[model samples]
Target: MADSVIEESDYIPGKDELDWGYEEGAEWGLLFPEANGDNQSPINLNSREARYDPGLLDVGLTPNYVVCRDCEVVNDGHTVRIMLKSKSVVTGGPLPSDHEYELHEVRFHWGKENQRGSEHTVNFKAFPMELHLIHWNSTLFNSVEDAMGKKNGILIIALFVQVGKEHLGLKAVTEVLQDLQYKVTHIQHMIQQYTVIFIFVLQIEEFRRLRSHVKGAELLEGNDGMLGDNFRPTQPLSDRVVRAAFQ
Candidate 1:
């Protein structure tokens, strides 16, 4: 997938448009049919209920993220997003061995308060923020636009964020928030080790890091230099089974 910044023209009426907020997301299904799909994401990850798939343990989720010096960070009127200019790919785990998913963009979802920012919750517990690393099946499609909406077309790795000692890897992004506070304006800079560190922490570090913190809420200044809560409400999991790689 080629590195591309999100433009106002890329907004679909009911999909990527900024007409809606977290409060108005419930009505999205009425405008966009895909919002009501059975396999919708941001579901509550019930750890106790999630069945441990031993297969995931065997295959393991592998990531090959490289530093992107030509990346651009943009505030698209809703959230802060980073467009990847380098080719970073991941394979194995739940994905099919025949295809490799290429990282395209990284988006941050935050809230007005720390207690409820993350899109996905754990045992009904919400986190301060959430990070979404979006990827497309590069082996099967030419671009992210071509792969979207197709079955097994996209894969997103969601990571919950909590308050802690300052994260050196994310400092570069936070420092540039002032420059990209307005919509469409972006800063071209190197996002060094941001992608690699997060993926590594998620897959290898302690899972308890996801727990909420008392000081976690005010992590990032949103689009307009305020606490912008840009996230969709949790969707129904329906018949989907969330498989876990660990026992």
Candidate 2:
């Protein structure tokens, strides 16, 4: 089956124009009706109106990430993706009790310009870029592919990027951009080990201070002309309500 699967290619006849061709758009409803589904992602987060759920404030998170060596990086013509081999497990945040998710891959999205590129926006404003850390339920599912078909199967954490100081953690990743100018190229990276147990409990003011301090590469400045706008339009919130852990 793997041999027959047609992966996105770098030099596909007219792949560039398909960037904003929203696969989840209503226009494609006949083919992929889920594109018009109610629970679609990358919603605009109206931070002010987000409900301050006390339960969300206590969202338990256990990030067991270790220093990874020789991870694969691929430019699949759509996005620059880093396929992780680290046994990074993230459990608790936005999930029910005792369910654990394993980090499968990390990918990026950005704009041709710097105004907006992230899939999810805050208060309807766009960020320069965004990082999606994709994970799949580890307890019930055997593999990430198998887990993607069920509800609560996959959990994605989106981190928005602002143009400011250069992120040290991402700096190493960016250095390889020059080598990846051509598409369909794959390389192995000996990444720096920045290990931290990410506890997403936004409990108190002091903890909020800790939250601000607890940073490594969540925020990043834009690099010129890295990749064009690779983001989906913000979907309707529908019946879903936004929840926040902190003010």
Candidate 3:
């Protein structure tokens, strides 16, 4: 938790977090209880990067990650799984428990270059690498960092590197290069750690494509909650009023 560490005061959720999901929105409304619920932005979002979150880099990246070791140009290979070495870190959440859970595993995600570094960031700073240390919020000695700093003090770390000069650790993840559809959570097959091998990484275009596909598909399905009403939609003004609301 070296990188994951904060003074305990930085946990405040941002406006995006406050306006985030339905559950979060419900909680947020309790405070600004009378604030306008109406949304005017395209797609009802207040901003473009509304869903892009740094915290997601911890939880949303693939967990049941697999890697490859065989390669021609640079030791290319298929996905081979590496087991996570288990040990505890500091654990203290809303409940009891000294040591949370152990360091689950490590992975990586890189881009073609620096300006587009990795997908995650802290305070908008982009480094050569963005390491992610995944520990159970539920485990701990001292806190989670205790287990995190044990080795390199960085377990479940994310290393961001340039596209050139192949990486040895990444061979474990990139080998399974084929992008098959992932329908369910991959944690149960978590090798020696949590359910994932490692991220093979994606280009900026690929990322945008993924986002578009997801958004388009979600809209097509018309999730009942997002759409609000499948059975009844607002009628044209003629049906509800003698004239219009102002008229």
Candidate 4:
């Protein structure tokens, strides 16, 4: 783990002997029993085993993320997070018509130089990095904190990241890593990494528009690495059915 990026509370040294329960450990069950539950996330996505449903074709995502110049970014000891202050929303996409979810925050996980860091895997193949964009069902919940642990209260969009040409949409945020180097977590003290949201706006708007035309699997595909391996091991997928849309 990078001492410069992670908070002392959330930092653990070796992957072979991880101290954090959020990683590979049994202690997680003591805090979040759901960690041992059947519906835990970050499961393996086996394409061959997934069920194709024509009806799922209608399940879509319509995002309305606006450009903002005054958004907040923080190093929450766990991950670097960017809070979306705009009333950005994602409709459809496995949600009921009445369930409208608003963008909450965006965070990422990455591994060391040679290690794969993605939380979810495709056929056991890990990606170098992953972006988790968390959302809350605002139509049903008054606040994101109130929706925690509630069924159908939260929605997380995971995107595998690949390293190649500089991602224009990620530049604005990533360029500020130097400023946030070794920043500790202070819930009341959220340091602003960037004053502008150019790349941030581009990323959300592009993905939102692309979702209406592309299948979920395609949109979620890619492989890349970033900082030290910060991803949790893939959890068991008990009684969970992987569904996808097929033409």
Best by lDDT: 1
List model 2 lDDT by residue over 92-187, tens digit each.
Answer: 655756988887877777654557777878898987677777777889898887776576676676677665554556655666655555446668
Candidates sorted by lDDT, descending order? Answer: 1, 2, 4, 3
Runs off by more than 4 Å, candidate 4: 1-27, 185-227
Per-model TM-score on C-alpha atoms: 0.80, 0.75, 0.32, 0.72
User: Residue-wise lDDT of candidate 1 within 1-247, one digit each (tens)?
Assistant: 0011111111221245534555567687776666676656567888888887676567677899998788998776567778998999999866777789998988877666667778788888887678888888899899888877666677777788876555667777776765664456678988876532232233212211221212223433432334355667777777667767666
| Regions of model 2 farther than 4 Å from truth | 1-31, 193-226
Q: Write the per-residue lDDT of candidate 4 for residues 128-175, one digit (tens) a residue.
A: 667776777898899887766666676776787754444655766555
Residue-wise C-alpha lDDT for candidate 3, range 127-199, written one tens digit per residue: 3333344443433344443533242222233344443444445443343322311211122221222222333
Candidate 1 local distance difference test against the native: 0.65
Clashing pairs in 2: none
Model 3 whole-model lDDT (C-alpha atoms): 0.28
Q: CA RMSD for every model?
A: 8.7, 11.9, 17.6, 12.6
**How do all the candidates rank in terms of TM-score, highest first?**
1, 2, 4, 3
The total of clashing pairs for model 3 equals 44
Clashes of each: 1, 0, 44, 7
